[model samples]
Target: MDSQEDLKRCPVDFDHESRTHASNWPTEFRELRGKCPVAWTEKHGGYWVATRYQDVVAMAQDDATFSSFKTFDPHSGEVTGGITIPATPIPRGLPVESDRPDWNMFRTYLNRRFAPKAAEARRAKVRKYADSLLNRVIETGEIDLVNEFTGPVPAMTTMELMGLPLEEWREFADPLHEMVFTPKEAPEYPHVIAGVQWIFKRCIETFHQRKTEPLGDDLLSYFAHEKIDGRAVTEEEMLSFCNNIITGGVDTTTALTTHALVYLNEHPEDYRRLQEEPKLLPVAREEFVRFFTPIHGLARNVSRDVEMDGAKMEKGDRVYLAWSAANRDPEVFTDPETVDIARFPNRHIAFGAGMHRCIGSFMARVMFEEMMHVVMVRIPDYRTHPDRARRYTSVGTINGWVDMPTSFTPGPKIETGLVL
Candidate 1:
């Protein structure tokens, strides 16, 4: 029904796998939105890009139409792609990749654990971890925030929450960090996949242990003990659930903290404001989430014929909800480019909307606030060398910094009673 000119006008050569393109994506997204809000891309087996805030939100809200299932073998016609743009080689995790009833079952059980109040209750633990990390670097006068602090805080916290071995934090965190950033052609790709496989094996062992002897209030125990449809959870479901929690819990927050530190270091005034007016940190956190949109956007598969913004999308087509672009939509936020630390009514979708919204959002917010507070107070005048920093490529998965070299005046170590 469409002519060559129509197709040419609608097609935008947007590739998330390209680092150069990812780096300057906001500009491209802006241009695309102005010309074609829902442009079709020939890249990655061809998919739709929803650039505007309204369009993205609408697609996200209608999960029935825009399914999260990943179709790996296009020839096989087997429908099973999760949120990732090019379906991840690994199995799709529970709740996130699943439709209702199953999704509702998982959420109902885990919701109480990640509620704001429960996350708040763990503030002391988070502070202890932050202080311990800062203590190691305060005397050195210089540090790599990504390797030393931001990466570890959430990884360690998630390990603690899951009752995973704290000693294995590096084992757990390394792959997640590398997988999201490294390209498939890079030498690190295979190693990262191996590391992820290692995690899967570890999760399976833990699941079995928890099933036999339920332990503390950790997620492992909950998942092991929780009954679904009056029967014990299967090994596959446990692996899927644990995988989702571990992967989701670590990398996203790490990327967020890294980005926030970089931004605040560039704009010292905002950093000072955070220190002087700690109350504003909550609102500022939301703004940072908006500005960074760390994970970028997630993908959804069209289950049925749908038309959006004058374009018709047929069933089996994949559409990407550009959260990062939507966050900067002029229609949604006035001067969306500018970072207003105290932006009120900041309804950002850094956390995906609808049934698949991030379960660890409350934990993310609490940890981010405390981490910022600690950094602002301890290393007030820290300076970052962007030239020395390494940013992630193929930001289709997560837009984050790899190495952030920072220096500040050496300060006395705090006596927080938290030993490294």
Candidate 2:
């Protein structure tokens, strides 16, 4: 097993970002977990995939050994140590893409807004957004749930929390929705890059403006004119932090919700069960999160030479912590492929583990619950058009649907009584 050929036998053909991987990744990950828990791949400039739950958890926890720090030089086209493999050409976001002391400051700043109690307090806002979004197409009977419903609620909620104009949610969110899964060779790739650049441009401007404006109760105002590590937060760090919030905030819950919609559409019994007993939505949400794993696996950079579960990782080597695979590992989950909504004590790593774990996780849960509960009550008879449905071309970054056209018995829209 130590030989190069033995490693190759672990199959050198895996590529998470490929179109084929979009369709066959679960099967491929299953094989990898069974054969080589930590296998190498030449794809994306060669990185190791840790499919075992224990190994991924270990790597995620030991951020010192597996650094989240990254740097991108736009002029030289040099990229190093980011969450994504092949290293994104764009600037890396804060906290998640950093290590140790620098990361801790950002994390602490964000905690005030994203902590469990803070997120819980946001349920009313989330529900109001969800209701308003549904009110748009509830009477149409036919709509693209992904475009109209799931996508907008989270985006608008994020904008509201940040004290930004709610009308501009789509402008800020669409590019990110496109960039996460688009293949590099696609004609739209350059467009996506431009949009991403525009995002940073807008973020930089807003951050600078916030500094001079009167402080408010919103998250951005709190961050505005803030000092970190004994100095004002720099422009570079500001843009990076803004990028992190937008990237992580807008799309993840939508991905999970759309995926669950597609699933429940295919399985009527599960839909009926949820509709019958609304209290079970939280349990089902965890199961869906575990099953879909919207953010498939996040990338990590090896800080120093280390070996885990017999995979000898070297300094500066890139690694992918396959949360999707870990969530489905037979060793950790009984009947791994089966979907049991009531599975308690589920040690799923869907939100990841350790220090750099998703900061918006509590916020995401509140968002999902409100949306799911509303959909269940309002669109109980809804049916998705799988034949015309569109999924992400490459699911390496986000395992999600692009277009989920659904039709339901036309229902009267409720009076949401909320205004931007």
Candidate 3:
């Protein structure tokens, strides 16, 4: 700690992607934020960690200096870097992993489709999906909400949006859900990678099918024929685009809703308030997003030498923006740990910041809100069994639960009349 070299080397021996280090994130990140806001870590090829709120925001905003671009060779299973510490072996996550003109080019084409109005338009379908999911487990009084409810609703919604068969939501979502929390060394990791690869292949085939059929009001139809920069969109671009939507769309919202629901189960006072005052749902949703901060951190490749919070990072060095750490910063939130539903002027970057910010954020909100509404109104007395609950082994990629087992008094299904 005394030497200059140790100072830049991140004295704490930080490893953001480790399964063992996940629980100690708060304590570890607090130290880094206080002692070295831009500390460099030997983990993940020696990347800089930005913990302070303003610093993280500043870096995220300046995409030119802090790039999200990365290259991948699917055939060789080689990945240079793209938006995650120790980047995983996957194709580019679309505009999220693109820089400058490419980012703008992709984002502009899809922005209107994911805009607030578009999300609002999809509300009824989200509610229908939520109600239908609960209908499956209501009579049994036992439910693993992560799998049966939270996971499927968003997956189904995403499928419906893509003009894919709603029944195949599992086929599309299961691999993504599995790949996020599973460790790289696990035996199933290889299978998970292959499953992901299959998803791209399916997307290509689906896009081609859509090209020949009559165009519809969906993403697949648009990508099948739409031109970007006066040229036809390639299958690679289509795969990247679909990958970003499917990957980013389903699991993050599931995680947020799962955490929020579990929190509600533990804190009956908050639940009572939310139930009695239905108008507080929207505000409470934001508070949950801020507190949970799903999609916690992402990486950016340094394009040039820049000094951030007294630490100088050279060109090509990777930097991890600790959005989770920034969300809990005392300077930004009055009491960062506590979940206050009425939190005002809340500026947490749960969805991220700048040009590369999450494109499906509004849609995510709709999905979360509908699911939250359905649970509170229908399963009022549902009780989660903590002993049987399982959380993600690693929150490095996404802070979420593996499963949450719950029991409730068996109730009759409310006929929604919508055939799923």
Candidate 4:
């Protein structure tokens, strides 16, 4: 096939119903990378597919040359598009889809919450919650791992971190999951959007409460009081800011936890190794995130006409940083296909890179590490129910298990008395 045809045939477009049912996505990506590193796919209504390690990495890092704000029109083939695939609609928030000074300003206020020390401070509480969830599962013998355990752990952790009422966690988590992994036209979309709106509204109300009462700890209090540009932030900005953190935090962490367990089940030897040498738990969590790449790709729009690898990309072109493809790139990672707990210099862009990198990365790392540690210590022999392994559908921007049925002999729950 000619280069243009080759680009048009790139298989990354899983948006189409036929391609959407794919069971072996990783293999498909590998095939695409080998055949055409920078191929264009007619999927997602036609967009460029960069499958190589270097291409994706460069696209992610070069914010000036590759902007992330263009909105693609599927029907017209217009490339100046939004960050989402299929050129769909979503409630806009600052920084996630913005560029430069504006993005930096918003990010600065939120970055403090996910700082390394702040994230570490939540470990004890996260571990307790993780263990408590597992305790419920251990008694059941067989549990729907995704819906029962993997999903709630992160949802609860995010709530705790945000200092929101735990009672509303399920209400928030269900809709967030639906919004990210299901089609927007689905019946669930309206409900999901409503749930998100409700959460944001509550956040706004809480901001008011915090302003008067001044709760010393938690994110809302910080945002309520924090000054930007030598003045207090506006309520709308605070709501959008909190929405960004909560929305991003809830689903991705759930996906990471689910993917990690699935990986452990698929590789029992690795699970046993982790159980034996608990010190490797942290490394294993990072490797799992890198290998699975819970969030598949992040989109960027080119701000200027740029030349990369002999190809000319025009101004306002939408460039996708394929984190999944990049994570498995052979050039950067030795045997990128294999999940090595000790993979050194393992700088994966799973959380992204540069100015737009995920602010919740440290918290995510802590949640994953603590959850994995608890699982390894308590339920060492957990295995997935092969017949019941439920892979998520319509997850264009994120990859995760929708339903994971795992069977394990839940050991006696250990009491690690650590306060939040």
Candidate 5:
């Protein structure tokens, strides 16, 4: 057993990379919660670490005090600040880093596209896409599930939702991946920035096209025409909003889908149960999000001096709402380490809480549930290639697999052709 002093310094740092890469982190986190629920560390210029479920919940809900704006230096802080982990530097004018009145306006415009009804309406299409992808994988006998199946599903779905050109899908996908996986200080930073600039330029062109030649059903058209505060949204605001949706919707969903499949493969009993009881799909999807927590944690800046969980936090201090740690906090969950699809009233913060909660959550859930349903029906006997499961390595904000190779008996091809 580690001493109290040892426990405080166990994780000592809260950067995404250290926690994700450290095999004993789960144990370290468990020990910290008991010894010092809100521990401080000097690693990333000092930040308070909240390991209890209630603390994270309170912090997430108290956005007034724990501001989400520019929290920490993404490069060296315990809490890798920014909207993401590993803290890729976002260009100025992006709405995610903005707060209050401005944030409200941007979220209002985005809400319409990601509303539950809109996502629910697309269920048929989402299911069809999943089925088609699974069919392709089955035909190949053995396949890299991440790149071959999971990656493309969300990429295609997000493109369709955003009304982006089909040809540019791959172009956008590359930058989104780099922004999440590659650290800003890495040698590839220049290349990643160039890719992001290219995509932003294309987004600008697309916004212009939508303005003149409206694609009535797409999100860009909606934003182009919608009035905020009884006035038109500026081009710059639209660009940032679009960028947020593109990156958030694409990479997060891809990581989630990849994790869901990997989790199901590792627990065949749970897989069989899900297949047998299809109605449990919704519950299972929520569990998967809770279990995998694709977006690990988000950063928040202290708006005012406040004391919390024994730590004297000053105004302007950066703090991390560790969703991964919070979700597994035994104070709120029983057997926090295990996967329980039936864990009802499971108030996990995987999608976060309060206003800034994931705008595309409904869409993500739809994609996940629909994909699970399609896979259960089409490839029920799937199994993962143990040696090829590739976990992402970076002090970043998502828990995902780079590649998940799988083997399964191919199901009979459907007579109705592929669904676009």
Candidate 6:
């Protein structure tokens, strides 16, 4: 709860790091969207929470005014704040942390690797992995959906794409999942940082190895060989690039799928409907992305004074663009709260907007669709244990499940030799 003076300054002062807040942020966001769309808070060294659809889009589109780069200090020209609010312990690099010209340069090179057309080619692999994951648990009749299926699928996908050792998938996924819940000052924070550092060390080693002996056409190879500004990208830049991809690619789709599963399990009719109407899966995927925004909202550093919807934001201040709130805005989607699997023309900001829109969106779509389609068709009657489910403690970066225990009728495994 905020003090009276804080409430006077901004009607709704939110603490995104609060576990209770994260658990029921949707309810809080709904109230904020109606009461005070552009609210401020003293939490995380003070930041604005933009809850309206229009305000979020306006700020997301204006990267120059609301810069994403946070590590670099405007005062002394030295790297200071980490990427997100309640700032991350380590410094992030291009292009998520970079703005405009620099962002475009890095983004342009990586775009080709994640283009929609390029992602389509990975469909077989996606389905193959989905089936393979289900094969291990199909006969078990009980499993933790998040740990067994949702989490590993994308982890394996991203690792394969990065040319990392597949056996080390948990090493990459566990730390990332833990980092989502671990605050900078928490006891587990040091362990989380250590895990990330280990991943970085592995990525740096891969970058060096790929430089010496180029392997398959993977992302690491792109980083190792691709030259920008007439020169190869530095190791630090390469590490940052890898960090962004790993972080973006892993839990987002997992959380989206996890939430979708939890919802579908709760409403068996919707699950049956999706199972029966396979054609609607594509549209359903969009609805799921909109309804269950995996990464709730991201922070932006205000580069200059700006006014939006009668709210004044000062320069150097941080603003949180509530994507989850914007998605549920009644002004945007019809009956935004209700889950409509058939909802079309969904103009959601789940993937963000402007130059910073998620680059792995295409792959995320492919992975999600394949996984959803397979699960619905195969394990349509899967039951999730809500009592045992574990959700992220903070919505600062991701709204995800740490574990979702589920059980379904035992079934046979399909032999799909689509593995490369």
Top candidate, metric TM-score: 3
Error of 2 at 319 (Å): 1.0
Show the lowest summed lDDT stretch of 10 residues, model 1.
Answer: 70-79
Query: In candidate 5, what are the lDDT values of residues 210-237, reduced to their tens digit?
Result: 8887448987777777777898877767
In candidate 5, the residue pairs with backbone N, CA or C atoms under 3 Å apart (3 or more residues apart, or in different chains) clash, namely 17-395, 44-78
| lDDT of candidates 1 onward, in order | 0.83, 0.84, 0.86, 0.71, 0.72, 0.83
Model 3: per-residue Cα lDDT over 261-344, one tens digit each: 989989999999999998888888888998888887999998998888778778878888989999989988898879998798
Q: What is the lDDT of candidate 2?
A: 0.84
lDDT for 260 in candidate 3 is 90
Error of 3 at 237 (Å): 0.4
Question: Model 1, which residues run further than 4 Å from truth?
Answer: 1-9, 70-79, 415-418
Supply the TM-score for candidate 6.
0.92
Weakest ten-residue segment in model 6 by summed lDDT: 1-10
- Model 6 lDDT, full chain set: 0.83
User: Against the hidden reference, what TM-scores do the models get?
Assistant: 0.94, 0.94, 0.96, 0.87, 0.88, 0.92
Q: Which stretches of candidate 5 lie over 4 Å from their true place?
A: 1-14, 19-22, 70-87, 92-95, 183-189, 415-420
Write model 4 residue lDDT over 1-420, tens digit each, in one string.
676453333345543123343356677668767876765556655556666888887777777676655333446665445565555444445557667767788777677767999999999888888787776667667777766666777888877776688777678667667666666578777877888778777788878888997556877787778787678988866765675687677778888888878777888787778778888777777788898887777666667766665456666555566788888988788999888977777888888877778888898888888777776677767787746765666446567766777888756655545211
Q: Which window of 10 residues has the lowest lDDT sum in candidate 5?
A: 77-86
lDDT of 6 by residue, 1-420 (tens): 455344334545588778778878889999998888988887867888898998899989998898887465445655543347767545585578888788888899889889999889888877887898888888888878887788888888888888888778779778877776676788988998899789889888988899987546888888888788789989878877887998888889999999998888888888888778888888988999999888888888888877878777777778888889999999988999989989999999999987899999999999998888888778877889878877777877888888988999989988976321
Models ranked on TM-score: 3, 2, 1, 6, 5, 4
Error of 4 at 115 (Å): 1.1
The superposed Cα distance between candidate 4 and the true structure at residue 216, in angstroms, equals: 2.6
Considering lDDT, which of the candidate structures 2 and 3 is the better prediction for this target? 3
Off by over 4 Å in 6: 1-11, 72-83, 183-189, 416-420
The all-Cα superposition gives candidate 6 an RMSD in Å to the true structure of 3.2
What are the per-model numbers of colliding residue pairs?
A: 4, 0, 0, 11, 2, 1
- 2 or 4, greater by TM-score: 2
